[model samples]
Target: MLIGAEAVDTAVELNAYLARFGYGQGLSIQQLWAEMDRVWAEMGLDNRRPLGSQRIADFYAHPVWVLNGLFADTDPTSVRHRQAIAAFLKDACDDQARLRIADYGGGSGALARQIVDRLPGRSQIDLIEPFPSDFFRRRLGYRSEIRFHDVLSSDGYDVVIAQDVLEHVEQPIALAQRCIDATRQGGLVLFANCFYPCIQCHLPGTFYLRHTFRYVLASPALSYVGAVPGAAHVLIFRKHGEIDVAALVRRDRIARGVGPLLNLLGQFHSQMKTLGRRAGLSE
Candidate 1:
């Protein structure tokens, strides 16, 4: 059984390094725990438990679908996504700590566990979620060396996994920097999400997914609609050293009306897979 973390313990555990990371105030363990309790009940979720001291949060739904989701969608079942995530973690792991991973905001640990299970070799995984209800669940196994942190104040990791957590943040660059800092000088920070820094769509403004709970410092709400992706988790990627920004650009130019058409094509392919399944053919 995992030895559950309480509010006070969370404060004591993270107090030493909290100041170093510029995490700001209103992060007392007790405060976060209470916030978790209130938020879950408000969402109408039945299960309740003390939030662990680490900065972990709720079980995420985005990456779950990518890794385990059975839904019919584009890249819904990612053999490539899992393979890519494992490759990223392996590339960032250091010899000093057997792959010191800082999974910030990895609430359910499903992705972390998935990566761990796929890797096969021994490695340590550290989860950082800041909700009380997250800590009390029986599924969160306890290990002396492997554990969770309410917040990430200390640095020195081979890989910092922040899948689907950036768009939700109030300060995207600062958030990216935090992950970069936790990473060793040459380590990597990998993340992803539905929103990008730019908007290719004709819509007047960009949008973000709505959180049922009012987040502590996440970006202030700017919309009334559901997320375009509709998944609870957004993924992020970080690297300790400078990233080659040039690679992101595509050499090919789109025709006048190709963007939406390209998107439609992606959807068409997704439906094709569903059609195949109905035909009793494996995708």
Candidate 2:
């Protein structure tokens, strides 16, 4: 029943965890955030360029991802996003119980907990995080309903969620396919990606999806279901079957061919929005 401020305070939890186990005993949460950034730089992860797949995997597998999730998952905006997704699920799966849900790269299991509270089901949540935080593991250890997985099966999930995951990968297309493949036919799949150059971890290579998400819409295996109403970033779809890989590849090729112009336009729009905010004309 906890919501808003009464919900888990990830900052406080992270601070305490760092003080107890990490090399951050005397540091504030802000300092820890900065230290994480510094460590990333020292590890050569913040090169601000497109990293290869192996490098991206190695970066994510490092223990720093634990800190990164703790720092990133509980802002006001992220809290509201979890609430919206929970509400959406409550309505979307009202008639169903015993749901099998998969959360792809779900970091700290906050959203999974929210969904469990709202859904009137004995659902099993498979948290597909390769590098799950120790905090998350210990906190949810007693909750058998929420299972952890380094990798997941290719199918049988009633719902598959990949919030804020696609942009961090080197091969987003392959990742997207896995998400789609993981869902059973007629099952739901939700994706929220920030394919912009917003942070060091969000790979620049994945920005191709910034303006080319229509390619996903055109897939034969999936039917576009609707955007999460309050959280426009989260899009829902239903998988029909396996994708027509050849057709999808051809469409993707065409999309990539036009990606440069689309990227330029997207950058121009962002610049204008920034300018408007600076001029006190927009928020």
* Whole-model lDDT per candidate: 0.45, 0.76
Local accuracy of candidate 1 as per-residue lDDT tens digits, 1-283 = 5644785575454444334323323233344334434444554443222223322234322122122121111233333454456655554453434677787766556556666765655567787765423332234565333567878765688767676565545444456556666777555556555443231111111122122111211221111122213232333333435323232122111221343454556669989988988889543
lDDT tens digits by residue: candidate 2, 1-283: 5446633575566566555534333334466556656556766774356565236566665555565555445556667888899899878887786789999988678888888887745678999997666667887887777889999788589999999888877677778888888889989999998887555676776676787875645776788888998899999999998888778777667776777689999789989998988989544
- Score every model by TM-score: 0.44, 0.80
After the best TM-score superposition of candidate 1, give how far the Cα of residue 75 lies from its true spot, in angstroms.
Answer: 10
TM-score, cand. 1 vs. native = 0.44
